[model samples]
Target: MAAVPPALGSWGAGQEYDKQPAFQRLLTAADWRPAVKVAVAPTLVLLAAALIAAIPSDYQYEYRFQSAGFGERFGSAVSMALNALGAPFRLGYQSPLGHDRTDRLEIALRVLPMTVTVLWCLALWLGLRAGLRRRKAVVGQLTRGQAAAEALRTALVLAAVSGLLGLLGGTEWNPSGRAAKPDYFGDFGSGAQKSGQPLITAGSGWLEAVAWTAVLAGLLAFLVHGTDALRWAAWRSRAVRGWAVSALAAGQALAVTVGLSSVTAFVLVAATSESGAQTGISLAFLPNLGLNLLGFGSGATFRAHSGLSGSDGSRGDSSWGDRSSETDFSFFDLHDLTGDWRWAGLLALVSAALLGRVAFRRGLDAADRLRLAAVHAGALTLLMTVSGVLMTRTTSSSGWIGSARMEISQEESGGLAFVSVLVANAVWALAGALLVPPLLAAFRGRGAGAPQGAVPYAESPF
Candidate 1:
C-alpha cells in the first residue's frame, strides 16, 4: 500500500505560508501589526500637541468675536490644528451689496510652528525606535527591504488618519452677515440699506488636504529611514562619512543658534507686561519669533507692503502704496531688545566653539576642515532659504464704500530677501568654520602639559 498522505499540521501550514508571494504575506494582519504599533503613539502625540497649540488662538478668537458658539469655536480650533500641520485654508468674502460686483478676499498662512513640529518628530522617532527594538527581539534582525517596508507602512497609516480627521473636522465656516435694514424715515432717499456685510467662506480644499498629507507622509518615511540609509552609505564610502560628519556639525551649529534665539525670545516674553491672552498668543508664536530672530541675525531684511486700489483701475486716496518697504537690520540692532550686542556675539561664539569642538574631535586635516566649512555654509544657506519660504504670510481685503471700491493688502519680504539671507548665512558659516578650530586648538595647547592623573595630550579625547 502507498504511504498515507501527511496531515496538514502546523508545520504544513507554515510551509504553505512560506510559499505565498511577498505581497500576499504583507496583506496579513500580523504583517501590519508592527506599523500600527509604531503609528499609534506618534499620532496621539501629534493630535494632542495640535490641540494644545490651538487653545490660545481659539481663546483669542472667542474673546474677539463673541458670536461664535461652541461648535464654531471647536471647528475653528480644528482648522488651526490642521493648519499647523501645513494645510492652508481658502477664505473668500462676498459683499451683500453686489449684483456681480462681489469683493473677494483670500488669505494664506504657510508657516509651521517649529515647536510643535519638533515635538511631533521626537515622538515619532521614539515610537519608531521602540517598534524596531520589539521587532528585533522577535525576529533577530530585519533586512533593508523589511525595514523600508515597515517605514512605508507606518507613514501610510499616519497619512490615512490625518486625511480622515481633515474630512470629519468641518473645514468650512458658516456664512455670517448683518441683515439689510429698511430706511423708515427715508432721509437718505434710498430703499432698504444693505450693510457692507460680507458672506464669508473659509475652508481648506481636499486637494490641499491630500497634498499636505502626502508631504507629511513622505517626511515621516524619511525621518524613519533616512538615518539607516545614511549609515549604510557612510559605511560603504569614506567621502560619504566625511559629508555625514560635516552635516552633523552643521546641524549642531544650527541647534545652538536656534536655542540661543529661543532663550532670547523666552526672556523677552517674560519681561513683557502684556495681558495673559496676549502672552498666550505670543507663546504660541514663539518658534516663529525665534526663526525671525535667526533671519535678523543673518542680515535678512523684512519687507512690508500695504496697498489700496479701486475696482475701476484707480488707486485709492490712502497713503499705502503697492511698493514694498524693506527693513534691513543687523544682529547688533537687537541690542535694543536684548540690552547688549554681546548677546549676539555670544550666540556666534558658542556656535563657532561647537563647530571647533567637532573638528578637533574628528582630527580633521586641513582639506577635511575646508570640506566641513563648505558643507556648513551650504547647509546654512539652504536653511535660510527654507525658513524664508515657510515663514511667509499674506492677507488681502476688498470692500465697496459708496461706489468708491477699496482694496488693501499686507505681505512679507519677496524673493530677493531670501537670496540676501542665504548669502549672509553662508558668509557667517564659512568664517566660523575656517577660523574657529585652529584658534580653539591653540588656546587648548597653551595648557597642554599632562598632570599626574591626566592622560597625555596626544591621547586626550579633546
Candidate 2:
C-alpha cells in the first residue's frame, strides 16, 4: 500500500515518443496549396526584390537618347533584377557604352533569392516543428523511404513552379530576335540599350531555375527533418548530435561565407573610392564588385577585356567586335588583372569555420567535433562550388570572324575557371574545417566546452 500502484502511462516519456509513428506525427496540408506556395517563394522573392528595386526615384536617366520609356525602363529594371539573380552564376554582361551600373540596389538584389531560399527552409522547419508539437496531423506509419519521398515531392513542386515562372518571364524577351542577343556572359545593359526589350530575355534560365529550385528544396527538407526527430533525441547517441552539429555548422559557414564576401567587396569599394582610384566605380559597380568579391573569396581571379579587339587593346568595345581565340589571348591579356584579392578568400575560408568550431566543441567530442566540422565544411564548399560554376563564365560573340573566331569570354581557359573556383575554395574550406575545430577543441578542452564524455587526444585513438 505504501509503494502504491505504478503511475499512469509509462516509466519514461522516451518510450512513449518512440512508440509514435513518423507519418502520423508529420505535417499535412489541407491541400496542395502550401506546397505550391513554398515552390513559388523563390520566383516571387526575385520578382518582389526586382519590383522594390524599381522605385523610380532610385534611378536617374543616364542617357538622353534613351528616354525613360515604359518598356525601356521596365526592361532595364528587369535586366538589373535578373542580373542580380544571375550574379552568382558568373553572368556579368556589361552595357555597350558602359551605361550598365552595379549599384547598391543590384548588390542587395543579388542575395535576395538566396535569402528567400533560407526563409523557405525555415518555414518548412517551423511547420514540421509545429506539427510535432501540436499533434495536429494523423496518418499511417511511414518508413524512412516514404518520408524521403515526401520531401522529394516538395522539391519537384518547387522545381515545377520555378520552371514555369522562368518560361513565363521570358515570353517577351526572346533573345532569338536579336537586336543583339541579350548577352548572358556580359553586360545586360547593352541589350537593354534598344527600346521594347525585356530583362532576362536569354533562353538559358529555365533549366537552371528548375534545377536550383529542386536542389534548394531538397536540402531544406533534409536539414529540417534530419535533426529534429524525436527518435534521435531518444537514442541519445553522440553520433546523432555529431550529425546535428555538422549540419548547423555547415549552415552557419555558408551564411558567413556569403556575407563576408559581400561585405568585403563593399568595404574595399569604399576604400577605393576614398583613395581616388575611382576605378570608374558606378552604381552598377556594386553588383559587379559583390560578384567579384564572391569569386575572390572562393579563390578565383577576375580579368575582363577592356577591348576585345585583335589589336593592342587600342581598339574599343563592341559586342560583335569581341574576340578571344588563342591568337587573341595575348591582346586581351593586356588588360588581364592581378590583385591581392585572394587574401579575402583566405579570410572567407577561415571565417566560415571559425564559429563552427565553437559550436562543435560545445556538444561534440574532439573527434566528433572535427568530423562534424569537416562534414559541415564539405556541405558549405559544395554550395560555394555551385556558386562558382555560375559566376565563372561571361561569354559574348561566338560567330566566325574571318579565319579567326570569336569566343568572347574572360576565362581564357574556356570554362575551367568555374571548376578552378570550385576546387580551390573547397580545398581551402575543407582544410580549415578539418583542422580548425580539432585544434580549438584541444586548446580549450579538459575542463570547459568539452562534450559530455570526451577524453584528451593523447588518451584516445583520435
Candidate 3:
C-alpha cells in the first residue's frame, strides 16, 4: 500500500476535492458565521455596557446584584436568564430568584457583557490552537513568506473591523458635547441650570447615538478579527515557527495583563474618590481581577512550554536560555521599575522572534508559540501604557474638583486638576494605536519571512 501523506489529506476519512453539505463541513462560510455571531453578541453587550457607563452620575437607578442575599457583583447573563425562567415577577422591590430583581438585573446587565468578553478570550485561544495543529501537520514544509503575509493580513482585517465598529459604537470617541461633559469636568450642567435651560439637549442625544453605534461595531470587529489573527499564527509556522510564535504570545499576554490592571486601578481610584472614602472596596475591581486571572491563565503556556504543562501548574525558569520556561516572580518584585524594565527586555526578545527575527538559533517550531504571545503582549502592553498614563493624568488633574458635588445650582469652573495630563495621555494613546500596526507588520516582513514549512488552516478554531 502506498504511504499516506499527512499534508495531502485529513486525519479522518476525506478528500481535498470532495464536496460536502454546509452543516457537515468544517471550514465553510456557514460554520464561520457562528463564530462571528458569537463574537458580535459581545460587542452589542459592550455597547450596552458603555451606555450604562455613560449614565450621568446624577442619574437615579436601582442597584442590582448577581446572587441572592447581597455582595455578589457581575453574573453571567446566560445564568441569569436561566434563573429568570422560574423567577417570580416583582414590582419596585428586589427579586430573590436571580438574586434581588434590581441587583440581579444589574448583575445580569454586567454579566451579559462579560459573557461575550470571556467568549472572545476563549475564541482567541482556540484559534491559536488551530493554527498550531495545522502547522504541525505540515512541519518542515511551507513557503515562509506566504505564511507571514497571511498572518499579517488576518491581523489587519481584525484591526480594521474593530476600529470601524469602535467608531460606530459609542466608544470610538468619548462624547465631548456640552451635555455629555461631567459636572466635575466643567460647568456645563451648572451653567445650564443657571441659564434656566435643559442640561441635556436633543443634539447631544444624536451625538451619543452615533458614538454608541461606532463602539458596538468596533467591539464586534475586535473580538472576531483578533481571534482570527491568532488562528492565522498557528499555521504560519511549521515546527520552527511554532515555538517562536508561542514565545511571542506569552510575552504579549503578560504585558496586556499589566496594562489592563493599571486601567482598573485608575477606575477604582476615581470611584473611590467619588464615594468620599479613601479606602473602600469596589465592585468595579472584579472585572479587572477577572481579566488578570484570564491573562495569567493563558500566559502560563509560555512559562511552561513543555507540552501543556503550563496549564497543569508547573512553571519553568525565567532565564533567557530557558526561554520556554515559566517563573513565579513576586508581586513586589514586579512593582520595581528596574525589574519591570528588565522584563521589558525579555518581552523584546519574544517580540523579536515573532516579528521573524530568530533568537538563540531557535527553529521555527520552537519560536512559533512564544513569538505570537510576544506580539499580543507588545500590542496590549502599548495600549495599557498609553491608557494608564492618560487615566493618571486625567484623574490627578481633575483632583478634588472631580469629586466635588456640582449641582445645577453651583458656580461653574471645575476640572482644572488633570486636564493637561488627560490631553497628553490621549495624544500618547492615539500615537501608540497608530504605531502598533506598522511596527507589528515590520517584524512579519515584506515577503518570504514566515520561516519555511509553515502551514495555514482554512477556518478558525473558535
Per-residue CA lDDT of model 2 for 238-329, tens digit only, reads 56656655556666655665566556666776766654334323333443344445555555544332233332222333245455543212
Model 1, span 125-242: residue lDDT tens? 7877777677668875555676667667776766676676566653344333323333432533122133334444545443465566556655665555455666666666667767
Higher-scoring candidate on TM-score, 1 or 2: 1
Q: Could you tell me the lDDT of residue 54 within candidate 3?
A: 45
Error of 2 at 242 (Å): 2.9
Shift in Å, residue 186, candidate 2: 28
Candidate order, lDDT descending: 1, 2, 3
Candidates' TM-scores?
A: 0.71, 0.54, 0.29
Query: Which ranges of candidate 1 are over 4 A from the true structure?
Result: 1-28, 53-65, 92-104, 170-200, 205-223, 226-229, 305-325, 331-342, 386-416, 446-462
lDDT of 2 at 337: 63
Q: C-alpha displacement of 437 in model 2, angstroms?
A: 5.8
Clashing pairs in 1: none
- As a whole number from 0 to 100, the lDDT of residue 244 in candidate 3 is 44
Winner by TM-score between candidate 3 and candidate 2: 2
- Model 3: residues with Cα > 4 Å off, grouped in runs: 1-32, 51-381, 389-462
The CA-based lDDT of model 1 is what?
Answer: 0.56
